[model samples]
Every structure is written in structure tokens, then in C-alpha cells.
Target: MSAPLLLILIAALAFLATHVLYEWLAKRLLIVSGAEYLVLGVLLGPQVTGLFPPSAVAAFEPILVLGIGWMGISAGTSLRLPRLVRIPSVTYRLSLVESLTTFALVAAGATSALAYGFQASYAAVMLPALTLGAIAVASTPAGLDVAFGLSARAGARRAAPVLRQIEVAHGMDAFVSIFAFGILIAAAHTQVPLMMRALTTTEWVVVTLGIGVVGGALFHLFLGSERSPDRLFISLGGAVILTSGAASYLQLSPTLAAFVMGIVLANSLRQPAPVDDVLRSGERPLYYVLLMLAGAAWAPGSNVVWWLVIMHYVVLRTIAKLWGTGIVTWINRAQAEVGLDWGRALMGQGRLTFALALDYSRRGLPYGDLIFTCAAVSVLFTEFFAARFVRSAVDPLLVPLEQLSMTLSATTEAVMESVTETMAQRFPALRKVDPDAKEHEHKGKR
Candidate 1:
């Protein structure tokens, strides 16, 4: 077999192994970190073991693109209008405030690092910063999923509210980052005249939306009245793959296009439930592959300036999340208490961040390697610390299930007693029979 094919087989096995390990660890520890898989990937990657070389990784780019496009679709479906309406206004406000603040702060920090710190050219500084900022706005869903899972197991009274905020925040951030990245990509085409460039970007966006609407409609029609899981998976998967390929061929944003398609499908009144199930079923394995490839592609420089840039990106991003969430909550008395735990809860970054970085790198953005490495390092940091923070923030709010059980038991017993007393008062013969009458009668019969 060819070396690239061999590498692909190894990666698939590794991905499966990681999934099993994650499940086992999650069950035992109540928290399973994805950082371990990344570390494993690094160990087996070109920079270390030289098992999966640059050539091998390059060969896998198409697969990565498909995975990323699917991710965008998954995220798009998350923005179901009905669900969004059900979310609290505070959750929406927090998501927007925190995401935008993170974007602005990261962009500023990156631009400064490039221009003043590293002394790069004007175009380099602006373009890299814009892409970096767009990428930094995302938070991984893994940490939130684990936190909420544990909270539910512990019967946390406040879990519902926290879960809602995190869900809304994560979902909104995904859309924001993808959309911003698309716009940035469009804006980066400077070969044409200013007027033509603006028109071109607008046209790309419109075309992207059009692709989504038409693709989604087609998907719905193809599924027809069938509810078979196999059929749903095949049809939806085929549509997404076609969409991804078309976007790549057109040099447009596959992520944005897939996202738009997802939105269309999700909002369609006649959309089948199996469609969602199919997407979710395929998302996990694809996510694992995406992250592993991201790790394999990791290459860091020895420059102090780059290190400084990474640190600046990390620190400023944190401050942005806190500051944004703080100001929003402080201004709104209703969410004041929630803001206290918001920033820490949102610190986790994972697959989506890596995917965005990978996308940026594939686009040949300036300083793309540095951005990817920084993102990888930052994701590791957040994964470690964020889990602890989520636990800490949620632990205090937990209402143990034992307490709930006891309360329920007491209420049930009281209700039974009240019913028995009412029956006894209404039926004098019943009261005369007494609680032991049946026992006495059985003894006599024996």
C-alpha cells in the first residue's frame, strides 16, 4: 500500500481508539479531556516520530475540508429558530457581548503583535490579525457538555440556567466566527479594484446563501416521506459532500455555505427528525479526525516574538470574555449573578478552534502557521483549566439527588396519608375494618 494510504489507516485506528478511551474515562472520572488525543497525535506526527509526514497530511486535506464543512452544518442546525426563541434573552445578550468582545480584543492584540512587536508589513499585520481574531471567538462544546452532564447527574438546581447560557454562547460564537472568517476571506482579495472587490465579496456571500437554500431544499425532497435512518444518512451526507466540493471548487467558504444549508434545513417545517440524528451520529468521529490532523500539522517557531504573540492572544482573549460578560451582566440586574461564573465556564476551546485555524492555514493566510500553533497551545491551556472552573462554578449550585429523593418521598407519603384519612372519614365501614383486618382474617382462614 502507498505511504499516504498507510497513514490514513493508522489515523482511523487511532481515532477509534481515542473515542473508546474517552468514553471509558468519562464514565469513570466524569470528565474526559480531548487534549490527550492531541498529545498522542503530536507524538506520532511528523515533527516528532515522523510517522505521518507533511506529504501524508497534505494528502488528507480533502478529508479535513469535508469534516469542517460538516461541522459548520452541525453548528448551523443548532440555531433552530424555535429553540432560539425558547432561550432566555439574557443568554442571547451574553453570547453576543462575549463573542464580539473576544473578537475585538484578539484582533487588536494580534495586530499590535504583528506591527509593533514583530514589525511586519501593513498588509500582513491587518490580514493575520483579522483571521486570528475571527478564529479566537470560538469555544469548544466538549467542556460545556461534560459540565452539564455532571450537573445533571448531581441534580444541580441551577444547571438548567447555566446550561442554557453555555449552549447559547457556544452556538452563537460558532456562527459569529464562521461568518466573520468568510467576510475576512472575501475582503482579502486585493488584486481587483476597490469597487470590484466589494461587489465580488457581496456576490460570494449571496451565492453562498443561495447554495445553502437550494441544497437544503433538495435534501428535504430527497428524504421524502421516509424515516429510515440509513436513507436519511445517505441522502444528507451526499448533499453535504456535494456542497463542500462545490464550495471548494468555487473558492468560496464551505463552512459558511454548509452553515446556511443547515439553517435552512433546520427551520424547514417538514424536515425529518432523522436528519438531525444522522448529522449528530457522524459528527463525533469526524471531529476526532479533524483534531488529530490539526495536531499532526502543528509546527511552532523558536522566535520570542511569536511566543509573545501567543501569550498576548491568550491573555487578552480571556480578559475580553470576562469584560464583555461582566459589563453585560452588571448592566442587567437579572443576570448579575450569572456573570460571576460566565467567563470561567466559557474558557474551554477545542475542535472548532483548531478547525478554524486549519481552514485559515489552508487559505494561505499570512502567519497562518503561527496562528495554528498558538490556537493549539491555547486550546490545550483552556481544556485543562476550563474543566476545573466549570466544576468549581457548578459544584456549589448542585442540589444532590438524595435531597430531592428525600423530599419527594416525604411528599408522596404525606399525600397517601391524606387520602387514607379522607377515605376513612367518608367510609365508616372502611375505618372499622382497620389496617390489620386483612391480616387477622388471613390468620383465621389458615
Candidate 2:
């Protein structure tokens, strides 16, 4: 898209962010994923309005990489291994059980189903399997105030143990899924140089890990001693760009490399909040772009009926999750610390799922579009039913949802500041009763 088109897109997004109907649909109805934009993107895509063609969608790939890298960094920073070890062993066990089972069942089912039924190449069959497997291991921690909404600290006190276990499990799941997805990107992806083509899959995987480790180390070295939030924001952006550029060139997962960089910085930084806050502040714009691209990629043809494959994909995931939860429940049947149908609590797939989805589209696989389409459908389906399903297992709990991106917050602040300064210059006396001074005076008066 040209600059004008980009501006129009931005204007439309700004409108959607504040629109009352969108508010009702997002906050009041759906479980709180940015999936509404994705569906909207699909509607305006080539399959529907043809406004966003494949070429137009491709134009946004660089931005897509940046967005995925941001998500990976967010995931990595969320974990502090020092604190992670403190969680009860039971949490790890349940998380592992559920994640592993879900991955095994869903991946195997998807691969087998596609191979037996669809007419795609081996790469196509394996691509979706790996993507789904990585995604399967993920669970969103959004709805809890400690997460996005579980704010009645005192009221939810009884659920504290529950919350901790779930959160730890969630972090672990994200870690594994991202790591595995990165590996899949390295191993199965086919964009190697002719000279490096002789290298084995194991070598590629090792290179992927190496990129992440080195990127992480370099990030810290470059960010040394910078404590200002503004500086941190700039450094973070630069790191994301560098790591993403390298990954894109190597045809590896940029998010995975950024994830490792985040982990390294996370462990090293005494004060990570400045950087984390800055990164998180920009999440909305990234998510909106990614969600739309993921949506716009779905122009399905008659080949094996893409919708049918998507349905099958969702069903397998649902069964795998439920079955995985059943196993966990049975294992913990004797323990009170464990909740029932823990998988239900984990039903929120959130951004990571979409992250992997969007990343898969970059691989140039034959059925890559189909994989992303399935993911968008899954995300939407999960977002719609997330809270409903959670209510079934835990009445006080809502499903995980990423809070809507505050895209306009910074712009709004800047505008307000500019207006205030302009007014202050116009009326010099107005500066005498500065808000800070007035607050101080009021406090003194009180």
C-alpha cells in the first residue's frame, strides 16, 4: 500500500478502536483477543472486497516480522527463571502433561489427516503439523487480574495457588511452543543457500539456537547501563529490528531469536520494567497488523476444501486439549491444589497462536495460507467461546485475552501536551497555576 493507503488504514483502525459497536463486540462480548480486526481483514481481503490483495499483504511482511519479534520478547521477559523455580512442582507437571499431550495428539492427528486426505506435498503436511503443535502447547494467562483481569486480590485469595500454577504452566507452555516453532522453522523451512543446502536439519536447528543466544548476548552488551525508559524503548526497537533482519535473511524465526534476546536481558537486567513497559506499550499496533495479515492470507480454493480442513484442525485441537486436561485431572485427582479441567482454563490461545500463524505464512510453503487460515479461525473460535468455556470450569474466572492495544495513547498524550504548551504560551499567567503546583497547594490546604 502507498502512504495514503497506509494513512487510510491507520484512520480506519483509529475509528475501529473507538467505535461503539466494536467496543460492544470486543469488550462486552468476545473473550478479548484482537481477532475482530482479523475477521475484518478477511472481509476486506481479495477473497471478499479485494482491497487487500496478496501483493498488498506481502508489503506488510517486514512489519509482521517486527510484531512477532515483539511478542517473543514479551514472552521471554515475562519469565524470571529465579522466580520460576519457586513454583510448586505440581504446576510444572500439569503444564507439561497438558502441553505434551496436546502437541502429540493434535500434531499427529493433523499430519496424518492432511497426508491421508489432502493432496499436498510432504512439506505442506509437515508445516501445519509443526505449527499446530507449537501452538497447542500455548495457553493464555490473560483473564486473571494478575493476568489481564483477576483483580479482586482479596476475593480471589482462595484462588491464588490456582493462579500461580496456571501462570507458571502458561509461561512454560509458551517457552516450549516458541522454541519448538523456531526449530520447525529452521528444520522444515527451505530457503537455504546452495552451499548451505548440504547442511543437515540438525545443523539448521543449531544455527537457529545460536542466533537466539548470540542476539540475546548482543542485546545486553548494547543496552548496558541504559536505565531511561526512552532509551530502553529505542534500544528495544533497534534490537528487534536487527534480530528480525538477520532472521528474515536467514529465513529463520525472528520471534524466536528475539525471545532468546529477551531471556538474556531479562536475567541480566536489575530493572526490566522500563524496557518491558515500553515494549508492551506498542503491542497493539503490532497485533493489529499481524491479525489483519493473518486474516488476509486466507483465499481458499477448491483444493481439498480448506474450510473442511480448518474444521478438522479445530476439532483435533479441542479433543487434544480436553483429553490432555483429562489426563492432568486424573493424575491430580487426589490433590486439592489442582483444578478440574485445567485445560479449559488454558483454552485461551491468545497472540502466540497468531504469532506462529503469521510466521508460518512467511515460509513459502504450498499450503501455508491454509495453515494461517486455520489459525485465524481457531483464534476467532477460541476468542468467542473462551469465557463461556472458562465459566464452565471456573465460575469466577474469565478466559485469557490480550487487552486491546492502546495504539492512540501516546498520540493522544502528545497532542494534549502540545495543546497545553500552546495555551500556556498564549496566557503566561496560566502557567502560574500549573497543575503540579495546584495539586501541591491543594494538598497543603488539606
Clashing pairs counted in every model: 0, 4
lDDT of each: 0.75, 0.70
Candidate 2 to truth, TM: 0.79
TM-score per model over all chains: 0.86, 0.79
Q: What is the lDDT of residue 311 in candidate 1?
A: 86
lDDT of 2 at 26: 45
- Residue 20, candidate 1: Cα error in Å is 1.3
lDDT, model 2, position 142: 46
